[model samples]
Target: MAEQLTGLAGDRVLLGRTSTAERVSDILRSRISEGYFPPGTRLSEDSIGGALGVSRNTLREAFRLLTHERLLIHELNRGVFVRVLTVEDVEDIYRTRSLVECAVVRGLGEPPYPLQGLAAAVAEGERAAVDSDWKALGTANIHFHRELVALAGSERTDELMRSVFAELRLAFHVVDDPRRLHEPYLTRNRELLHTLQAGDRRGAERLLDTYLADSLERVVEVYRRRVGEDGTGAS
Candidate 1:
């Protein structure tokens, strides 16, 4: 296994199977998700490589991976940095989430969310919320929605949703209160589950759509507070 990442290595440990580049990517990814570097924060190859005992090539590869994932933004010469998530990006994400997930709920037959991987995901979210592990909570939140929508059984949709969730988690890192960002929805999620479980597909879909709309509004408001005209003074 890779050494326990601390100091320059940060929170992710290296796994033996992972190449130096992969390990570097994981560390950088985790750090970004943990809010160590906010959106638009610059990353230096020499600095990160030297700190992690990696090489420029390896760190470059890592940056490429995150950039592809939309977790990092690459510039022509200025260098890569965490994406300064714009209101447009945030809105698009929520819009896609609603379009996709609302359909998933509408498609469900009954009871279990049935991804063969959902209950565990929900349990993890509850644990993170209980322990106040915001990052884990974010991960769990993403996973829960994944399982919820995986019921639609579409590989393409699953891939798209995962991409959106990764970017959303980066946003989550900036918020001071994780639960406040998501806590208000747990009961709502439970209610949706109950509605689905009762074979009330119409009710579940309606509820989910409204919840998603309001949830999107909340996050976008916070995004505005942090990066919109009210905050960035850029646009």
Candidate 2:
């Protein structure tokens, strides 16, 4: 875990004048989404503050912000730790994703739909697959979905989906085989992209619905196997 957090070093650059706490929160949040800080790992104030060059108070505020986002949690005696998502959390995430993502595709009101973001994401996913970088592949998958939601042309919905994908990454952190978790989706992402580009909105929506449902079922099964019936794994 220390090594994972270490990779986050130099990834943060403080702007000329910015909210320190919020910047720290954004850095930490990006790390969490990238699987640098895996689920249930305790966050040390001294270590993080020292690493990121932020004061303890700022770090604490950042922790509080992440806690509110459901990415971190505070225990009574123990310090803050990354939130460990459950099977139910997995279900809820997919539920929300299906509604939002499919709608974005299904509700295209104009002939000229934006494909730049989606195309770029799909291309990145293909590149990640070629390199066999499952972790990068996972991040690319999240980006693909974010681009999908961006199709709706609403900042609020995009913000909401960003949080949704962040929470989904929590569950993804426990994946024993990242390749198995993300590789299969690469082709499907391309397929959905093509379907939309071909002007088959209804077909694209159906593919997305099935894609999300299959992914949810697979993720839930793997999560159950990892955490067991009582939600305890080799953490």
What lDDT tens digits, residue by residue, belong to model 2 across residues 146-233? 9989989999998888888999999988889989989999999999889888888888899999999999988988988897543467
Give lDDT: candidate 1, residue 75: 82
**What TM-score, computed on C-alpha atoms, does each candidate reach?**
0.74, 0.88
Each model's backbone clash number: 2, 0
How well does model 2 score by local distance difference test?
0.87
- Per-residue lDDT tens digits for candidate 1, residues 1-235, read 3554345365344443247777788788777766787777899888888889877777888898889888898888899988877777778888989888988877766555554465577677788778977667667767778888788888988877867877887667556566688776666766766676667889978998999899788887777776673325253
RMSD of 2: 9.2
Model 2 scores a TM of 0.88
Clashing pairs in 1: 2-14, 111-197
lDDT of each: 0.75, 0.87
Candidate 2's C-alpha runs over 4 A off are: 1-18
Pull out the clashing pairs in model 2. Answer: none
Output the lDDT of residue 61, model 1. Answer: 82
